[model samples]
Target chain A: MQFGIFSVSDITRDPVSGETPSEAERIDAIVQIAEKAEEVGLDVFAIGEHHNPPFFSSSPTTLLSHIAAKTKKLTVSTATTLITTNDPVRIAEEYAMLQHLAKGRMDLMLGRGNTAPVYPWFGADIRQSLPLALENYNLLHRLWREDVVDWEGKFRTPLQGFTSTPRPLDDLPPFVWHGSIRTPEIAEQAAYYGDGFFANNIFWPKEHYMRLIKFYRQRYAHYGHGTEKQAIVGLGGQAYIAKRSQDALNEFRPYFNEAPVYGHGPRMEDFMEQTPLSVGSPQEVIDKTLTFREHFGDYQRQMFLMDHAGLPLKTVLNQLDLLGEEVVPVLRKEIEARQDPETAKPPTHAKRLKDKYGDGPARQPKPNANRGDNVTGGSPYQDSE
Target chain B: MGQNFQLVVVSAGTSDPSSTRLLADRVAGRVTTLAGKKAQTVGTSVVELRELASEIANALVSNHIGPKLQKAIATLQRADAIVASTPVYKAGASGLFTSFFQILDNDLLIAKPVVLAATAGTARHALVVDDQMRGLFAYLRTVVVPTSLFASTEDWQDNGLNKRIDRAALELVALMTSGFEKSVRDESWGSYQHEYGSAGGTELSIDLDSDLMKLAAGGSAGQKSAG
Candidate 1:
C-alpha cells in the first residue's frame, strides 16, 4: 500500500487571476510538494522527466539528488526515466549514485518519454526507440547487477570491459517499474523480469488499464515468478481534494481546464468521467480509490497527480494535508483487511534483492561456489569453459 | 557491514590488454579475499586527451566528450575504495586523468583511502608518486598509503612487483577494518584548553564533504530547515 504524488511540472496561467509561476517557482513547488508528501507519511515522490517547454525538469538526477538531501525515508524517483532516449549507462550510474545518496530509498519508473522531438535533440532516432529501449535496458540491467561486463551492442560503442559505478548502496540496485499508458510491449518487458508494471492509469479507463495489468499478471506468472495475483502492480490517478466535494471540484476545474498538457483537449468534467481523475472531497477520493482494487487488484503503489493542472503550491499542500489526514488512513486500513500477506507484498529493496540474489546475506557468493578465493566460477556474468 | 565489496580498476592506458587494471585487480582481489569478502571488479579504460585531435573541436566547445565519459565520472564517485592506475605520460600523470579530476567534487575524497600505482616505459617519472599524487591526495584530504607501487613496463610482469601488491592489500585491509584515527584525537588533553577557557580550533569545513557533513562541522553556524 505505498502511496504518494507525482508532478508533470507544467507552469500554467492561473485562469482566474491570469497569474502563472515562473519555471523556477514550478521547480521549487515540486520540491515543496515532495517535502509535504513526506510530512504526511507518503512512501514515494516521483517527478516526471520532460525535456520540453512548459515542463522544467530536464535533468531529473539533479532535482532528485536535491530532494534526496531534503528527505530521509521517502523513495525519490522519476515518473518517467526516458528509457528510449537517454543513455542507459548514464541512467545506471546516476541512479546508482542517487541510490547511495538516498540510502536505498530510490527507484525509477522507466518510460519511452512522452515528447517526440526530444529523441533527436538527444541524438536518438524516435523510429528506433523501441529497439533502443530494449537494447539499452538490457545493458543497464547488467550494469547494475554485474560488476564487469564485456558487451558489444547496437545502441552504443563496444565495451571491451566496463562497469557502471557507485555500485548501489548495500549492493542492492533500486527496484524498477516499467510504466506504460498504451504499450503492451512495456507491460511484457516488466512481466518478463517480474518487475512492477505501472499503468499511468490517469488518462485511460479502468477497462484498458485492467487488460494491461491482467496481461502483466498472467505473463509474470508465465515467467515463473509467482501466481498472477502475486504480480506487483501500481496505478496512477489525478486527484484534487478539499473539505467538501463541490469546493474541491470548483477550485480544481479551472486549473485542469487551463493546463497546457490537457487544456485544449477535453472538458474537465468529461475527462474526470472518462479517466481516474477524482476532483472531490477527501472522503470521495478515498472511496473512489478503494474501488480501484476491484479493477486492478491489490496493487503496490498508488500515485496522485495533484500538483499538475497548474494548481497553486498552497492549494496542492492543502489537498495533501486533507488526503494524508482523511484519505490514506482509511485506504490503508481497508486495503490491509482485504490483503493476504503471502500475496499482497509491497515491492521493497529487501524483497527485490532477495528475489534476485536469494535468501542469503548480501555479501555471500552464489550458492554454487565452494572456494572463497575463486571469483571466477560463481559469477553468472562471464561464461567459464 | 556485510564485508562484501566490489573492486574498481581504473587504468589510463589504451594498450591491447590493460595491465594497470589487471594489477589493480590483483591488489583489490587479494585484499577482498583476505577480508573474507566477495568482490566484483570494474575497469575504466581511458582515451588520452592528447589523442583527441579529431574530437578536439567538439571537446573544446563543450568540455564534455559525450555521455560515455560523463558516466565515467559518476562511476568513480560510487566506488568505496579506488585503485587509481595511470601511465606516466610526459613528466607527470596523463592530462586526461588530471582534467577528469577537475570535473569531480574534489572535496568528496576527504577521508577515502586510495592505493596509488603508476606504470611507464622509463622510470624517470617515478617522482609522480610523491610530487603529484601525494600532493593531490593531500589537497583532497585522502589517506595516501606510504607504500605506492611504481614499475617500468619491463618489470610489469615480474613476480616481485606483486609482493608490493600483497603488502598494500594487507595494509588496506587493516586500514578498512580499524578505520583511520586522526592525530587530533590522540593529543586531546593539551594544557591551554585545560588551564584557560580557550575555544580551541573549531571550524565546520574540517570534516567530510556532504552537505550534512558541512552542517555537522559548522557547529552553531548551521541551521536545520523544516521540509
Candidate 2:
C-alpha cells in the first residue's frame, strides 16, 4: 500500500495560542510540509482545492507543480480536483502541462466539490452536479486519449477539432481516482471507466464506505475491466499521535473543539470511536489502520489527514516523521504480506506509459502552422511530413 | 385470502406515560381491528423517541445513525403503514419528532400510508396535526389519511376524540388493504427523485439506462461535433 498525507488547506486559528497564520505563511508552511514528507520517505503529498475564504489552495495544479519540482521521489497530487465546475478542456491542458513539469510524478483525484455556492460561482448549477461531473469527465477522458477531439456536451460549448496542447507527457494521462464521500453514482462511474475509487473514510462510519467500495469493486468486474480483487481502491483517514494516548487526545482536543467542518459537534473521544479519527500513539495508529484492510478489503493507497484543524507546521512535520518512521514501515510490510496476489498495484506515470506504449515511441502531436480555422482541416496536427 | 401487514407506530413523547404514546397505541389497535375485517393481519411495532433521544442527538452531530436508530429506521421502512404521533411544544411539533424524520431517507416513505396524530395540553393546538405534521409528511410524499387525530386534556373525556381516532384508523386500513402504496411506488418509482448517497436505505435499485448514464458512456449524436 502507498501511504501519504492530504491537507484540506484550511487556514484555521490555533486554538491554544489564539493566533492564526497569515495566508502567505500558511502557503509557505504547506510547501515546507511537502518537502519534509519527501525527506521522511513518504510516498505522496496531496493538497485540496477550495475557491472560498480561509482556504489557500484554490489552484491545486500550481501548488502540486511547485511541490513536484522540489521533490524527486514523492508524488504530488490533489486530494480532489473539482470536476463538476471546472471546464474539462482546461483540466486537460493544465494537468497535461503539469505532467510535463513533474516529469510524470503526479496524478489527481476528482470530486464534485463540497461547497454548494462554488457551482454558481463557476457558472454551473448544483442541481445538475452529477450530470456535470459525468459529462465533463467523459470529455476529459477523450481529450487525453484522442489526439484531436470533436466533442459537445450539455454543460460546455462545442469543441470542434480542439486539440488540448502539451498532449500528456510521454503520451500517458495521469491516472485518475474518483473520490466521493457518499455518492454511489461516482463509484459506478469510476468502475465503468476502470479507474480507481477513493472513499473519504475519515468523517463517516466504516459501513458507509464499505458499501460504496464493495459496489465499485463488483461493478468493476461487471464492466469486464478485471476481477473484483484486481480493482484499484484508496481510502482517506485521520490521525494524531504522541508517545502516550492521553497526550495525543489532550493536545488535539482543543483544536478538535474549535476547528470547522466538525467543530462544536461530537466530542473528540466519541468522534474517534465512531469515525476513523485515530488519536493515540504510533502503535494505536498502526492498529487502527490495519483494521481498514479487513473492513474494505485489500486496497492500493491509504492517505491520512494530518495537517488540518489548525495544527502547527512543526506538529504536522512531527506527525509525518512518526508516520514515515514508525507507522508506514510496519504497515507496508503487514499489508503487503496479506494482500491478494491478484490485486493490482496503484497506478504511476511510468507504469501507465508502459501499459499504453510498450517499447514503442509515444505520440507527439505537431500542429500544422497557422490554419486560420481548424474547421477546414481533416486533422488538426501533422503526423508525417 | 388473508395477508400479513407490518404497522409501525412512532411516538415522540418525552414522559414515561405520555399521551402521545397512548394516542399512537390507540390508533394502531383500532387500525388492526379495522384491517382484520378485510382479511389482513397487522403486526405492530412501536418506536418510542423518548428512549432514543440521545442516539438521535448524537446522530445529528455526527451525521451517522447508531445501531438503535438504524434498527428503528429499518422497522419503519418494513412497515406497510405508519401511525406517527408527536407531543406539541412551544406551538410546534417536538424537536425529537422532526429530528428523527430528518435523518430518514427521503424515499423511505414515498406513497406509504400514514395517520398523523398530535397531543397537546390545550385544544388551541389542535391544528398542529394538520398545519404542521401534514406539511412535513407531504414533503416526504406519504399518503397521509385525510382524518387527523388531535388529543387535548379535555379530549380524553370527549366522545368526539374516539370518533376521530376511529375515523383516522379506518382511513389507514382502507388505504393499506388496497395496496395502493405498493402499487404507486412500483409503478411511479422513476418519477420520485432520491437524495444523493441514499443507496443503502430506501433506494436499493438504480436505473443503468438513465439519460445521465448514457451521457456518461458517450453523448448523443447532437453532442458529437462535425469535423
Q: Interface RMSD, candidate 2? A: 3.8
Residue pairs in steric clash, candidate 1? Answer: A166-B78, B204-B217, B204-B218
Which candidate's DockQ is highest? 2
lDDT of 2 by residue, A1-385 (tens): 6889999999999998888999999999999999998998889889999999899999999999999999998888898999988999999999999999999999999999867899999999888898889889988998998877887667688887777887888778888999987676788889989999999897776777887899899989998999999899999999998989899999999999887877776667877887888999999999999999899989988999999989999999998888889889999988888888998877887777777888787877776787776352556568733
Error of 2 at B158 (Å): 2.3
On residues B41-150, what C-alpha lDDT tens digit does candidate 2 reach at each position? Answer: 99999999988887788678767566678789889878899999999999899999999998788788888899999999999999988899898899888999999999
Note each model's CA RMSD in angstroms: 27.3, 2.9
Candidate 1 regions exceeding 4 Å error are A353-360, A364-385, B1-227
**Candidate 2 off by > 4 Å:** A359-385, B33-41, B58-62, B195-200, B221-227
Candidate 1 local lDDT, A88-123, one digit each (tens): 889999998888787777899898875678889988
Per-residue lDDT tens digits for candidate 1, residues B1-227, read 34444345556655646665566667777767766642333233333333433233333333323333434544544444567777778878776555555444444444556778787778787778778877776775566677787778766767878888888877766665544422322443231122111111111111124332222121121222433
Worst 10 residues of 1 chain A by lDDT: A376-385
